[model samples]
Target: MSLNDIDNVVEAFVKGARVASKSGFDGVQLHAAHGYLIAQFISPKSNERTDGYSSRPENALRLLKRIVSAIRSVVSKDFVVGIKINCADYTDDHDRHALVLDHFRTIAAWGEVDFIEVSGGDYEKPDFLATQTRSPRQALFSHFSRTAMDAIESLKQESTLSAPLPLILLTGGLRTPELLHTALAARHAHLLGIGRTSILCPDLPRLLKEMEKETREVGTASSEAYWSSPFRPEPDLTFSPIIRNLVPTIPLVGAGIGTAWYVVTFRRLAAPPTSKGMSFEPDYNLGPLGAVFWMWIWVDTRPTSGMKVCRRRLSPIGIVTAAFHARWPKSPLCKTLMEYERQILGLKLEAGSLGLKETLAGREVYTHVGWLALVSGAGISASTTYIGIVRSGLPALIHERVTSTPADWNAFLTMVRDININDIREGAAELRAASQRERLMEERIQAMEVQCGIRAAPRDLYY
Candidate 1:
């Protein structure tokens, strides 16, 4: 962001906080996680400015600091103010987990903040937030959160107490009672947060509290017992592990795919099961085929033909090729993806073909928050941007993947368009384009400034 816009951005935070504070909300958590504007300023890969905002580590935090101060000034001291931050950038060479912790330490120590929630990864590499696998590694970000909590704890002990020391909230794969209880018992997190599991089982909070009560009574119920309570959601049951493990061809990654899955889950949980034979839970209803198509639409990357576009800093080989020299289709990696989808999902696809209008027509309006819903295949073809490539782009890109046979491909694309699959694509396309347009205008301004000998480069007074 431009320096001139700093005050305006800070004003937005303060104003929003005041509104929330007056609206009877308990507190407001500054969303500094998952590649938001605050996350961008904190991330080294995105923040390249040479001004005071980016000159040093503390300077990089100037925007957040100003906003925090402004929010505190407007709201009463008792009104809680918190911040959620990513532990890592997850991009190559931009590994700044330690730096983020130190920055977090400084903020928590200043005592302006009430609580700190630690999350990691953004759309560029969102696996930190949502892993590709059903049973992903647990507490991937605990080390960072633990370190921050320890630092803040020391600061509280070293200094005189004003308010209680800030509590740490850790989110990421803390689904099971065992994981949640273990983390809290070990002081890895003062509060435990669950994500997809909560969507799968909305009563997770009550169940957990009840389970805690039960455990206190029995005193010997193991992790196995906690899951076997029957009220506990089998969150991992959502995906066909064999199929989900494939494609994106990488191990334990793919944020776009994960978001898409959660979106589908959120939609299912939002409504009752269909009266028809079709189950709201796609995984249970469609089986392996459903999972394959899930990956196919959300995470799968295809080979590019002819000329290449320079979207990223590295070679324009695309994500798949950048990892493997050959095309994803020909490569042995994720070989099971298409095979399973064609065999299994093909049946579901054919069923839709018969009653496409009746089945999917009303559901287009299902997702209230479009991106999180993965509505119209959002994040399906993301490259330059973290969010999916929008509804139209999904079909456009999928058209390339299914084009091995011209007749089959043309027929499929026709069916896709007929079903209004790209309903949300227009909005996604506009949002994705706005950033690129801004970048283009900035580049053009820089070139003109150089020609005019105004300076070696244009300054970030573009607020």
Candidate 2:
């Protein structure tokens, strides 16, 4: 960034800290980790600038130092200011790694900072996501955290400040309570951080408290006692091994896809309760394909509300059909479209009707029309006329071919046994034939109208 840009950037951080304090936050942590903008400037692998920010290692930290000072000027002493820096970027070079650690020690020496949260890796080597399972024999990031603590301790002894040393927070691979307790006890890190595990078990702290009570009653104290207590963390899902093997592993596809899965889950958890009901449950069953689909398509992510028929946008032909139907409701085209819509809706209601009926047999079936926007307003006739085409006629055709014996999710192959390529081909052929016949009839009618003087002939024909 230019000199002017740097000034604006620092000012923005100061403003953010000010707002955070005023808004009743405990502290603001500057994210100079995980290949972000500030982290980019700190990493020699990425930063190629000849500016003051990149001239030397100390100068590389100049941006963060400026922000810390600016924040201190605005917020109270009680308002904690922490910086999350990389333990080291993914590099094999010892000198480069040492330089990165030195940058961390330098920040710790600065008295204004309250805490330093150490996290490693970036988009290139995203061990930061911690989605992959590491070998139980070797702990993740334990060595790095220990070395970082030693560096901090060395800085504290050299400094003349009488205040306590800044706390070190180690994040990544702190899944089990056993590992967390061990990390703290060993002084590997003063604090610990959790990520994906928290999403899987939101009430983990409460669960742990309950386990501690049970274990105490059993006269057991070891962390392993809780392992048999019926409260184990759910295995976090990711791409299948087949997919992993298919892609080049160096730029790990699982890391990116796994992150997307977590992101989609976050959105689901944050969404407010709809008119039908709230779907607070995390979709753990969501596969890699569904993850990409939901991430890109907004409408698909929207939870299927009540058992009502949902409609989608009408195609160009569908709009014309609707208009023609509205003008002549008794016409063959109008009648045929109406019949198609009714048949499709019947199929939908039948397919999803069983499970709900068995559970809520007597209760009224509440229909939800989520796609009302497309099927309403001044063009209501045009929209409603093509209701059969909701998300394509493929769904209706598939439903027709499949058995009406209610869905058996366990026997997924059985449920889709009848929906073969032949059925799909037949459906497409029928649709094409119908569209061609309709177009020809429409042209013939227009010509007949002009000859009978029911409609004026084109003046250009005589010219």
Candidate 3:
């Protein structure tokens, strides 16, 4: 769905909650946690708008208020409304802690929200902040680091000043019974939101209670192995047949086809027309089928296509080729061409591999079907620039496989290594050439001046 469509759905959901409350539902908790839409809007880095939705700190709050207000219009005043916010997104700038706290302050004043659940991080950077998948690998003491404990303490302190909402649910890294009890004793959190642990051990609360009676300490409840034992491997759930059947085929089809077209169109718009005044109009010539084919080809053979149109000069044939190529390379396009090569070659390129460096340096030759063109035309010079700014900036686009899978991480490291080496090589060559030219000119000027002095030392100063 388009962004506007998502916005409409969110607004409708808020309105629906109010309607449900009016119909006798108890309350509604706006699900803003785990780096969902609301969380994206709340993040300073994510919401870069300078307009109504982007300006003042209050602008950020506006979307949340609209949702709440829509709910309030339909629901009774007695209904309980609350927000679950991330205290610190692991991926967000560390400096954004202030903004996060400020956002919470705004929510607290709303009077509609009855509670706030302070979690941390988005899905992409989910270590302990949003998910518990990595908890087993962590050192026992690693969970209670000063930063983690301090952030929790700060959230607790902030909630105290929050209007009337007396409840704060802290979720993230709070696995051990000892940690939970300590937090409870210190009044850091009211509800212990056990996400991964609960998933692993469904009856953890009961088990903890039973263990509490048997022992005075908290750690006696369960070992890491015990918690990990009950963990069921999560299965990949495909879209339901109903959804597959009901959703319009156009969007899926459009995305499949139009991605490259959109990129080429956007790139053409970004820059001045070439010397010939030739312009790109993907829809006009390519049509939907052509656009889809180009989009697919661009995705498949991103390495070859991504670099070709870096300057955004699209000939009629280029457009046709883009359409043809997109469809030609059919598997779900990896963001990078190196990824495609790795997949096809079935060779793991580890960090610092010379071959990996060669492949990445050669990436400029592999033109990004659509997005990369748009990115490069819009001023992304290199793949790293695209990754750092565009990919990292958008939570949805930031591929999390790098952290979730060791192989992905290794691939990323290799790519980065190659990019860095290429940059250094180019820079060093330029600097050396420039230095040699400067030295040669200096020697020539010195020789000429010496010859002039030898020819004429008898010039009259006053004359």
Candidate 4:
């Protein structure tokens, strides 16, 4: 991008904050982790530009520093603005780790940042999902959060800061109450970030508190802290036992099962919060396959759930099909597309019905459109919000397969220079770069673990 374009690049982030402030959001968290654009400018493995922002070690954070400054000026002084940053960039090189620390220290030392969330993982080196086991484990980035906090303290003393210490929020792999207390007790985390586990139990905080009370009342305090199972099976649902036995080892299918489990639960959750009619109890019997179908059916039949997805997706063909019995003569390709989808899914067209949805003896014909997005590379459509749920709701992952951007930076610059839509091209290209970096970082991390005579621990990203 040109020098003129670079100015807008920084301003755009500030503009986003400005818009968010106007939109009545109390705050905005600037994302600078996961090998994204802000991170690309910070990481040595990726940034090779000769510009002032990427030239020197101190200059590595120049762009984001400017963004933070611009945003602070644009938003209301008390408007909460935080940044989510990595503890490290995933390679085993200690020098790079030091550089990563330096970049984070710069951000933490700033008075403008209200809080800094510590998380580690770039697209190439992501360990996004921590272990799903019932056993307790430290959240993945606790050490880094501790280290970052310690460094920030040293910086405060060295610089003789007048501002208060920025808060630290740690994300990834937080589950049990014991684990929660441990991190806070260490003084590393000022706040906890509950990701997937919260989905399984919507009122997880309350559940943990109740479990703690029950254990203490029984004088079971001598034993390791044990929370009651977050999962519960329904009386009519016998599927949980079969699913538990069937596929506990498969992560992809397991992730799908876990995600599907939550989406099905969220349907009941969408019920009015004031009303006590809905229960949080989940059907353990519904495996990933069963869960996907349940989600599709719920969203389609229920207007509230369906509107978010169908508004963007339901094609011209589907509209005519839903409202009319005759074939849509104007759009034969639309008919052909649905026909192909049904054939691939092994389903006959429902007579006088546009959707694949049907019920025969309590069995529903469900199509996995979002899963097919990954498989057929068709991108996200149908139950797209649930797709957002399944794939970590980060925007890059949702519409990932749809965009085309050069993997290499030079090609990216060429496209950017030629287009007025620099932001779109830049975002797509940076996402590709992030993916490449993640793969490289993962390999490096494993090799380093082997050299140190330690097994690569599950969900442990920082070495």
Listing every candidate in turn, what is its Cα RMSD in Å to the true structure after a full C-alpha superposition? Answer: 23.9, 26.6, 31.8, 23.7
Top lDDT: which candidate number?
A: 2
lDDT of 4 by residue, 272-355 (tens): 444466546555556557666765554234343312234322323443343322233343333444444434222111111122
Clashing pairs in 1: 289-345, 379-388
Model 3 residue 223 CA deviation in Å: 12
List, in order, the clash count of every candidate structure. Answer: 2, 0, 20, 8
Quick one: best TM-score, which candidate? 2
TM-score of each: 0.52, 0.58, 0.39, 0.56
Give the distance in Å from residue 172's predicted Cα in candidate 1 to where it truly belongs: 1.4
Ranking by lDDT: 2, 4, 1, 3
lDDT for each residue of candidate 1 in 1-463, tens digit (9 for 90 to 100): 6667888788767767866766578889998877889888877768888887882686877888889888888777789988887776632344465566678667876678888887776666555645432333244577767777887787766656575678898876665666666788888878777766676677777777887787777746364677544443343434456665664554234444455555555544544445755433434343334533543443323333432423342322244454443323353433343454333333332222211221133332221122223444533322211222233234343444433333454664564554443644753575567556655454444333322323321121110
Q: Model 1 TM-score?
A: 0.52
Give the per-residue lDDT digits (tens) of candidate 3, residues 1-463.
4558657865666556745553467887887755677766666657776766663676777777778877776556678787776654532455565566666656655666776776554545543332233353133223222333444345446544544543566665566666666657765666666654554355566777765565554364444334333323322222357655764654334333333454444434433444575633223444544443443343222345433333232343555455544555563422354544433222211110111221233343222222344335544355442233222222222233232322464565553454455565665576567567645554343333332322222222111
Q: Judge candidate 3 against the unseen true structure and give its global Cα lDDT, from 0 to 1.
A: 0.49
Error of 1 at 454 (Å): 35
What are the per-residue Cα lDDT tens digits for candidate 2 across 1-463? 8879988889778878876776579999999988998888887878888888882776888888999999999788899999887765734678766886787677776788888887777888766766433432125367777877898788756747666667888776666667677788898898887777677666778877986686677755564666433333443554578876776766457666776677667656555656565435677688777876666554323333332223332222433344445555654432344454444344333332211211122332222233333335433333233223222323456656443333354454566566778877876787677567645554444333322323333322221
Question: Model 4: residues >4 Å from true position, as ranges?
Answer: 133-140, 221-268, 271-276, 289-298, 303-463
Ranking 1 against 4 by TM-score, winner: 4
